[model samples]
Every structure is written in structure tokens, then in C-alpha cells.
Target: MAVAVKKLKSTSFHGHKEWFTEVNSIGQLHPNLIKLIGYCLEVENQFLVYEFMPKGSLENHLFKRGPQGPQSLSWEIRIKVAIGAARGLCFLHEAKPHAIYLDFKASNILLDAEFNAKISDYGPSKAAAARKYVATGRLTAKNDVYSFGVVLLELLSGRRAIDRKKICTEQILVNWAKPFLGDKKQLFRIMDKNLKGQYPQKGAYTVATLALKCLSTEAKFRPKMAEVLATLEQLVNPKMTHFVI
Candidate 1:
């Protein structure tokens, strides 16, 4: 019933034609992706009907204020959400020839009635798994992993990926939290205080370790999506007898 309607006419005729075609070809995405039920492409008008996410975007939940989104999320719920997002990314990375989600950010992740995460906004940049990174000349998967790492850090600290006030410089979340990630002795300072020391210390260590791995300066050192998913699974069910040794 919910529809996303947008103007079909781009600034130029060329732009409009390109977008019109692009939207049409982006076929069935993963279930974890916000379901695109259908679309209508008429002259000068384009509309996409998506399964409405009553809970709304993860951005509002994690970063915004007021009645729309709460100030904090429970550690359990946060880990669950992280797992769903990871599963979605894993599907993309392992798809035939591979699918890449270049824009993997809090804003792009949506939540359904049960607070389940679903990735959205599958644009051209995300369609190809082998796209070259502009700066490092690596594959796009690394860039997506970097973005996901930033989201993980945000979830852990209950802070934005880039916070001007809390950060001493322009280094952002990773730079600000790097010390805490490596030094478990100072872990308490970096974790979201809302948890009130309720999280399992072992699980916390696992998550912190994964966050550091994802933030590794060398892209090659970052764990694959499959590895990330396994770690998150362990965090949620620590008694499952799977240790990341």
C-alpha cells in the first residue's frame, strides 16, 4: 500500500531516460532487502511500491531523537539487528558473480514491525561486485565492508559514525573508538552506557574484536561477510558452543 513516488523527468532528458531504465532492471532483491512490490513508470511520473516498514529506517532508530525513535536500543536487540544486516550483505557478496551494496549505511537499513533489519536503496553502485575502488583500486566489497564496520561501531557506542562534538578531531567514530576496541581494559568507556553492564563480557570482547578487524587499515585483513555473520551469531547465543578461537 505504501508507495514511493518520484518525478520521472530528470534535469536533462538523458538523465531521466537513464534512471527510468535503471529502476526497471533492478529486479528482485534479497528478502532482507526492503521488498519492492511493484512500480509504475509513466511519462513524466515514476513510482515504486515497497512493503512499508512501519518501524522506519535504522538511522532514525540509532541516531535521531524525539518520539519517532528512541534514544537507545537494547544490546540484545542491537545484536539481532546487526545479524540481519550481515546476512543480507553476505547474500550479496556470495551471489553469482556477486552483488555489491556500495551504500551500506544506517540510513539505508530499514526495520519492519518486529524490528527486523532489511537493506534498501539498491542503486547502480551496488549492482556489480567487481567495481574498482577509486582510492585504493580494490573491489567494491571492501568499501561496503568498511561502511558496515562503521555501522557496527555506531551500534556499539550508540554514537553516530561521524560525531563532531564527541570526537576530538575530524577522525570520526573508528578513530575515536580505536583505542577502546584494542584495549579491553578501557572497553567500558566506549560501550553504550544504556546497557548498564548487562551484556556478557565475553560477547562484548568478541564484538569489539570484530569491530577492530573490520576497521583494519588494510582491507585484506577484514573478515569476509560470512565470518562476520558467524561472530554475530555467537554474540547472540553464547551458549551454542561455538568459540571464535
Candidate 2:
């Protein structure tokens, strides 16, 4: 297995060290979490080591399709990746004392050889230790939920969260897609055309609804990570005939 080393500058050493320590203690136990193999903290040097992911971040696969051709992620694999990442978030939010992943984004979700998604860059418990210090309301699990919803949008549309290259009103992925989420016909219009009409229509609509819920303007309306996981589980289960909401 390969290893990823994150070296911190001397100026940011102390804060990063504390963050590493927090993750080392609380994040290593989960299967879906990137294992903190070890760390180095010498006088002026600081570094964090983690298991290297072969397929790289979900962001790469989702938006960075190279000059070769269109390499879009299939609907089935996208759902699988979503479920795995959600499980990691569920574990963190349900842990004793509860941990908030303040920086949950597409770049933080890595993929293994089989394209199995694993959450990385959770930093430390101290990252969101103070609720009042957060710029967005409170540092709570719902914050992560909202970020996860953005990632879900990325998966569905294969678009960047913020694409300045696009024209105005279409630059922000969520804002451009939000208006279509409630309507099934409009939802299909926003889906990745690379998918080429191969995905399950009903399942896609279900996930679109879930993503909208996760992106709720009010945090209270966002489903808990556990609830999100359950919904994803049902979406991906082959035997699931009927889905609720």
C-alpha cells in the first residue's frame, strides 16, 4: 500500500499538529476513514501520513476528465461512492461526543483501486471544537450534511461546485440545479449527459430529492448523516422495490 505525506509549514505547525492528534485518536478506527498511519513532529517540522488512494479524489474523476475523452463515472459507481462516503460521515457524527467534519468536499473523498470511496482530510476534533467560532452558524453535523449534498450534486451532474468558466447564473452548481430538483423532468435535464440515459429514472429522482433536502436552507430540515445513509442504502439495494420520499 502507498502512503501520502502531508508536510506542514513551521508557521502552521501547532494548529496542524493538534488537528493530527485529534484525528489519530478518533478517526483511525473506522473502516471508511483514511487510516492515519503515523505522523512526524520534530522541532520545526510537522507531517501527517495516511494510506494512499490509487484512484485519487472523487473530484478528479468527476470534473477533471482529461483531454483523452469523456471519462464520466457511471450512475451505479456514483451511488456506491456516495454510500461509502456517507457511512464515513455517519460514523463521525455518531461517535461519542460527536465530531463535525468542517471541511467536507469532493476533494476530500478519495477512491481505492475498485473505486470504493473513503473519506479523508477530516483534520481533527479541534477543527470544529468551538461552535461560535464557525463562520456558518454553528459547527454542527448538519454543516457536513450540507457539504455532502454539494458532493452529491457533483456526482449527479458531473459538474464542479463552482465553475467560473460557465456563464452567470450557471457558475454555481447548486444554484443552477436547485430549481430543477423538485421536478422529475427538470431533474433529468440537469443530470450528466455523459450518463447517456442509462440510469434508473426513479432512483435518480429519489437521490435528487435527497440532495435537495441535504441542501435545505434551514439546517433543521437537512437529514442527519444516518438518515442519509439509510436513504442511499435503499437507493442502491437491487431488491428495493419501493422507496419512501
Candidate 3:
């Protein structure tokens, strides 16, 4: 088993101590979360040890080519990964104090050997501490839902959320794909070309539709993480539709 050691510079120790405490408390207990093995906080050294993910982050798999060659995650694997990450976020949202992930993005999602997804870098302790300091803080679960929608877009379209390489509207993945979300005829145009027409059109469209709801301009309009999980489960296994939401 591999382990990842993240070291914080001495200059930033005090700044990140709260985040470290938060991870130690909440991250270790969640299976779908990256386990925080241990930490070291000596006189001038600070480091966090976590369970290593052999496959690295979903961001790397989605946007960057591997050393050997280009690799694409199959539609099935993509759905599975999305569901796993959703479940993790759901757990965080439903925690005792209702944790809100401020930094939810593809790069923060790690994949194990079998490509099981785990949500990482969510500093629940920090979130809890922040509420005490900022009475007007607007951190909410809906923010995470929006980020999840962006990840879903990445899975479907194989593009980065913000890619400068593409020009104009195409530079932003959401803007580039938004127009096609509602049009079945145009949906195919935005899909990852690596899929090579092998994905189930119905499933792809279903996820795209969900992604749109998650990316709603108004936070209140976004579906709850639990609802998102239910819909995704149904997408993966049509038989699961019988399970009441």
C-alpha cells in the first residue's frame, strides 16, 4: 500500500494548522474520503500523511495524457466515479454540523487502483471554525453541488473547466456544453470523442440533464446531493429506479 505525504512549509504552518486539525477529525472516519493517516507538527515542520491513490486524481485522467499514451475512462467507469464522489459529498453535507466543501473540484478527487473515487481536501474543521469568525459567510452545500456538476461536465465532454487553449465560448467547459445540454441532436457533438460512439445515448443524456440542474444559476434550484446520488444510481443500474428517493 502506498502513502502520500504532504508537507507544509514552515512559513505557512500557522495558516494551515486549523485545516490540518479538521482533516484529522473528519477525513479519517469516512471510507469514501481520503484517509488521513497521521501528521507531524514539530517546531518548524508540518506534514500530513494520507492513504495514497495509485491512479492519482480524476483531473489527471480526464485532462492529461498518460506517459504511454492517451487514455479515456469508459462511460460506465465515469458514472461509477461520479456516484462515488457524490456519495462522499453527501456524507459531508449530512454530517452532524453540516459540513460544506469550499473547494470541490476534479483535482481534489482521487482514484484508487480500481478507479474508486474518493473526495479529498475538504477541511471540515476549517469550515466549522470559519463560521465562528465570519457571521456573513455564505458557504453552503449548494456550492459543492455546483462543483459536482462541473465534474460531471468534465466526465461527459473530456474538457477542463477553464482551458485557455480553446477560444471564446469554448474556453469554458460549461459555456461550451450548455447549449448542447437540452438538444439531443447537438449533445453528441460535445461528448468526449474518445468514447467513439460506444456509450449509451440515453444514459449520457440523463447525466447531462442532471448536470444542467446542478449547474443552475440559482443555488436554490440545484438538486440536493442525495437526489443527485439517487439519479446517478438509476443511471448506472436502471433497476435501481424502484428505490424511493
Candidate 4:
């Protein structure tokens, strides 16, 4: 099996110590979370080895660019990846000490040969929140929920979280998509154009609503990872209605 090796430029960087701490904090393993094969801690450099995700990141597939042009992902595949990534986050949130994935983004989500999503580049939350987190001194699982909401928006619209390349409204996905998520008539306007009208309309609306719920400004309003996973499961399994976001 092929493996991906990550090279950290300097041992002096603060993140290097945190990386070790995060690796040690992990207790049990989940299928959706990328497995850390091993690590080398040298005075000059640090390296982390993980299972290679041949399909690469969800970010590349979501954003269209380069000479090859748009490599659109099917609706079915998008749901599959979203659910898988959610499962990984849910697992982390339910751990003994419980972990918070501070940096949850499309780029951190990886895919195997079969398009199975595996979350990578995870660590324990910093004592202080990052830019995405709402509370600086107190970090919580809800912060991850907010970031997940942003990613869900990316999946639905086929855009970046913050793309300076685009014109005003199009630059930031959350700002641009929030208005449309609640409006049934306008929801389809945000659907990934690459889908080409082939995805299920009802499922699209459901996912949009879920994304909106996840993005709620009040941390208390954001559903737990387990609830997030349950809502997402409803997309493919329409029978799921009890916890429909």
C-alpha cells in the first residue's frame, strides 16, 4: 500500500510540539480518520506518515481550474463523501476526552480509490480558538460544526470557502449561499452547476437546510456531530425523518 509522507519544515515551530501532543491524545481509531502510520522526530525536521489517499482531496474536485478543467463529482459521490467525513467527526466528538477538529475543511477531507472519504490533518484543539472558532478562550465541538457548515456549503455549490478570485458576492461561499438555503425557490441556484441537473431536488433542499443549521451563529444552535451525521444519513435514506435537520 502506498503512503503519504508529510514534511514539517522546522522543529522549532510551535505546531511541531502540538502535533506530538495531538498524536498522543488519540486513543481509539476510526475507519474514516486517516491512520498515522508512524513519525520521525529529528532535531532539524519532523515527518508524519499516513495512508495515501489516491483520489486526493475533496477540495480539488470541488473547485474547477487548471488545463484539464472541471472534474465534476456526481451527486451520489458528494453525499457519500459528506456522510463519511461526518462520521469521522462524530467519532472524534464522542471520544473519551472528546476531540475537536479545529481545522475542518474540504482540503482536509481525503478520498480513497473508491471515493471513500478519510479525514486527515487533525489535532487536539488549541487552548485558544482559531479564526473560524467563535470563542477564543473556550474551544468547543460547536466550532467544528461551524467549519463543517462551511464545507457543506462548498460541497453544495462547488466553490471555495473564501475565493478572492471571484467577484464580490461570489467571493465568500457562506455569505452568498445563506440567503438561498432557506428559500426553496432559490436553493437550486446554489447547487453545484457541474451536477448538470442530475441530482435529486428534495435531497438538495434537505442538505441545504442541514448546512444552514450547522452554520447557526449561536454555538448552542449547532447540532452535535452525531445529530449532523443522522441528518446527512437522511439524504440517501429518505426514510430517516426523526432527526431531519
Candidate 3 off by > 4 Å: 11-22, 129-134, 238-245
Cα TM-score of candidate 3: 0.89
lDDT of 2 by residue, 1-245 (tens): 67999887777555555666677776667878898888877857688789989899988888886798766888889999999999998998887656688788989999998988898877554455534456565567788899999999999998899999999999999999999998986787788877887788788888999999999999999999999999999887675343222
Clashing residue pairs in candidate 4 are none
Per-residue CA lDDT of model 3 for 1-245, tens digit only, reads 57999897887555556666677778767778998887788856687789999999998988888887667898888998999999899998888777778778989999999999998877655466546644565656788899999999999999999999998879999988998897877898888888777678778889999999999999899999999999998886654322110
Model 4 TM-score, 2 decimals: 0.86
Q: In model 4, which runs have C-alpha deviations exceeding 4 angstroms?
A: 12-28, 64-67, 124-137, 238-245
lDDT assessment of candidate 2: 0.84
- Residues 66-139, candidate 4: write the lDDT tens digits: 48888899988999999999999898778765667888899999999999998887655432234235345466
Regarding TM-score, does 1 or 3 come out ahead? 3
Candidate 2 segments exceeding 4 Å error: 15-22, 125-137, 239-245
TM-score of each: 0.82, 0.89, 0.89, 0.86
Better of 2 and 4 by TM-score: 2
How high a TM-score does candidate 2 get? 0.89
- Quote the RMSD, in angstroms, for model 2: 3.5
Ranking under lDDT, best-scoring first? 3, 2, 4, 1
For all predictions, the C-alpha RMSD in Å is: 4.5, 3.5, 4.4, 4.5
